[model samples]
Target: SRAINADTGVNKQLTQMILKWRRPGQELLVGKPEYKSVIEASLGIPCRHDELVMEVMWGMKRFMPSLVRREKSELPKEDLLPVSQGLQMLLSSYGFDVKPEMVNDQIVATASVLFDCDAAEKKQYRDFHALGRHLKNVSGIEYENWDLLKLATAFKIITSFLQ
Candidate 1:
C-alpha cells in the first residue's frame, strides 16, 4: 500500500519544525509519550504519521552502546572510609537517587561515621549515632535508644511473624 504522503505530500514546514527541535540529545528520549508531545508541539505533525521513522530512530539508539566504544578499568578500594559503612548502607537504599560510587570520595573526605573494626571482627555491635542515622535514612524511622543488633533482631522477628 502507498503511504499517505504519496496521496497528500509531506508537510515541509512541519518537517523543518521537527528538524529544528530534534537536537542531538533529544534522539535517545526516555519517555515516548513525552517525546510525542514535544513533537506535536514543535511540528504540526499528526500522531499517525510514519511510526516507522520513530521505530527506526529508537532502534538505532537502542543499539548505540554497541556502536560506541569505551575503555574500562578497575577502581581502587577505599578501606579507610571517611564516611561510615552504616551511612553508605543507608544511602544505598535509595540507589536510584544516591550513587555510592560517584560520591564516595566526598563521603570519605567528610570524616563522618567512625566504625569499630575490632568490634566487627569480634562479632559485637554497638549503639551509635550512625545506626540511628541509617534507620532514618533507610526507613525514615528514628529510634532514640536502639542498637544496631537490637534493630536487626527486631526486624528479623517481625518479618518472621508477618511471613
Candidate 2:
C-alpha cells in the first residue's frame, strides 16, 4: 500500500479516468431513464451499490488469496482493510513505509477538493469502477469469462468480515 507514484503516467491516467467517470453528466451515471428498466429486466435482482462493490472486490481477491485470511476466533470471514487506518496498518505490516494508498480509491483524494464523495448514486458507480481498475492492476490477474463473477463474489464474502 505504498503511495501511488502520482507523477507516473499510469497514475495520471487513473486520475483522469476517475475524474471523467465521476463528472455529473457521464453516461454511466446518467443512464438513459427509459432504458434502465429494460436493462434490468433480465437480471430481475436489483443491483445495490454496496453489493456491486462487494462483488468487484470479491473478484479481485480471488486472484490474490494470500492477501486475505480468517481469524480462528470467529467463523471464517474475510480480513480486509476495514478503515483508512486499518489500511495503513496493513501496509506497515507488509513493510511498506511510504504514504499509504487510499483504502477507498474510488472515494478519491485529489478531486475531493472539487467534488462531494457522498452526494449521489454516481459516487458508488465511480468508486466501483475505480476499485475494479485498481484490482485488475494490483492483482496481476488476466481475468476472463463468466467465472470472473464468482471470483469477485468470493472475495467479497471474505472481505466483508473486515467491514
Candidate 3:
C-alpha cells in the first residue's frame, strides 16, 4: 500500500505539472500540494476544481484564525472600517438609520441599561458580553471595559438586526 501510494503520488504530481503547463497562465501557490493530495486520495485518482474549492473553504475555516489584526493603513483595502462597521452594516441591512460612528455610543448606553436592569436582564447581557470577550481576544484589540461593553452591544444589535 505504501509503494502504491508513493507511485500514485508521483504520477499525480507529474499530471498536475503537465496540467499546470498546458492549461493556462495560472500557477499553483504554496498550499496547493496538500489540497491536491487530499483530492487525489479521496477519489483514488487526480484532483479536480470542485474538490479544491470545497477543501480550501473547509481548510481555511479549520486552520485560519477568525480575525487577523493589521494596521488600517497597511491593509490592502482602503474602505475597510473597524469592527464597528460590522454592526452598522447589520443595522443597515435591517433598514436602521444608525451610522457606524454612532454604534459605539449606542453600545455604551445599552450596556449601562443592561447593568441597571433586573437579574435576568443582567444574565442575558452578561452572556452577550461573554461572546464579546471571546471575540475581543480573537480580534486582538486593546479594548477597555467600555470598548468591550460596546462590542457586546454591537454584537447584540447586529444579531437582532439579522433576526
Candidate 4:
C-alpha cells in the first residue's frame, strides 16, 4: 500500500501541476470543473474538488502579493489628530505637559531613530536628550523645553508592550 502523506512525490507533482495550470497571467478562477477534469486526466486518478480548491487557494495566497502592485496611501493630518490627542493625554497623566501638535513630531522622530538611522547613529543617540537634540536639528522641531527623559520612558513602556 502507498503511504499517504503531504510530503509524498505525488503531492509535489500535484502542487506543481496546479500552480502551472493556474498561473497568474491565465487569470483562471479556482475550482472550475474544467480544471478538475484536466488534473484528473493528467494524473490518471480522481481529483477531489475540495483538495484541488484548497491547493489553488494556497498557491494564490502565497504568490499573489509578489505579483500584485500595491499603492501607498498617506493619512491626512485630521486623521492623526486622535492619535496626537491620545499621546497628549497619556503624557499629561504622567505629569508631563506636552502640546498635542508636538506629539506628531515626537512620533516622527521616534520612528526615524528606530527605522531610518544606522546602528552607529542609534548608539550615538542612546541618551534620550541627545536623541531629542539630534532629531530637533534634523526636523527643525523645538525640543529644548520638552522632557526628553519622560517621553523616552513613555516610548519604552509602549514599545515593550508591542514587542
Evaluated with lDDT, which candidate comes out highest?
A: 4
TM-score of 2: 0.18
Q: Write the per-residue lDDT of candidate 1 for residues 48-100, one digit (tens) a residue.
A: 32445544443344334445545233233542222334455545543524444
Candidate 1 similarity to native, TM-score: 0.19
- The digit string of per-residue lDDT tens for model 3 on 1-163 reads 2322433444456556555565344433323456556435643345445544544543343224333433223321212222243344445554667643444435534543544564566676677667766757777654346543576667777579779
Q: Which pairs, if any, clash in model 4?
A: none
Cα lDDT tens digits for candidate 2, 1-163: 1112323222345446545555454322211332334323422223223434544544344324334554223212333333334334444654655342333334323234323433444565555555566657877654333243455574587479769
Count of backbone clashes for each model? 0, 6, 0, 0
Q: What shift in Å separates residue 18 of candidate 4 from its native position after superposition?
A: 30
- The lowest-lDDT stretch of 10 consecutive residues in candidate 2 is 1-10
- Against the reference, the lDDT scores of all candidates come to 0.47, 0.41, 0.48, 0.50
**Which pairs of residues clash in candidate 3, taking residues 3 or more apart in a chain or in different chains?**
none
Off by over 4 Å in 4: 1-71, 84-86, 108-163
TM-scores, one per candidate: 0.19, 0.18, 0.21, 0.21
| Model 3 alpha-carbon drift over 4 Å, by segment | 1-116, 142-144, 147-149, 156-163
- Model 4 C-alpha RMSD to native: 18.2
Worst window of 10 by summed lDDT in candidate 4: 1-10
